[model samples]
Target: MLRIAGILLAGTGAAHFAAPQVFDPISKAAFPDDTRQWTYRNGAIEVALGLALTTKKTRLLGLAGTAGYAGWLASRVRANRGASQ
Candidate 1:
């Protein structure tokens, strides 16, 4: 289960970096400057989190981080929606 989650995370991160244009709108709305950088940074972070999840020593930490990351992203999306409105 953990391995699958890690693979999924890594895959999505790879997708983000491979085709960042798909994330441009969210990046632009969530970041104040250099939206491209934000996109890449996010991709990198996801990749790291995925790698961490694959390691037994870090699996718990990685799961916590993943949850936190998801929550943070959701908050950002909500904030962006409010700002755009």
Candidate 2:
């Protein structure tokens, strides 16, 4: 399970770097003035987190990744709720 999660994280991280345009809009909506910078930062963070997840000594990284993902999810939910109302 951890391996699969690690692979997925790495894949998504690569995708973010490989195609920032795909995520730029979301960043723009969240932070209008600095979308590009934030997008790149997010991608870099993901790459680091994914790499850490692949190693046994980096459980802290996995925990951090989970926290980051949860924060993203929460933000998305908040956005959705605001949009619906």
Residue 64, model 1: Cα distance from true site in angstroms: 0.8
RMSD values for the candidates in order, in angstroms, are 2.0, 3.5
Q: List the residue pairs that clash in candidate 2.
A: none
Q: How many steric clashes between backbone atoms does each model show?
A: 0, 0
Candidate 2, 1-85: lDDT as tens digits: 6766777877887787789999887666555556688778777777777777777898577868768876984686566554432
CA RMSD (A), model 2: 3.5
- After superposition, the stretches of candidate 2 with alpha carbons farther than 4 Å from their true spots are 72-85
Query: Could you give candidate 1's per-residue lDDT for residues 1-85 as a string of tens digits?
Result: 8988898898888878899999767677776467789889888889989988987999999999999998888887777765643
Lowest summed lDDT over 10 consecutive residues: which window, candidate 1?
A: 76-85
- Candidate 1 colliding pairs, count: 0
lDDT of 2: 0.73
lDDT value, residue 65 of candidate 2: 78
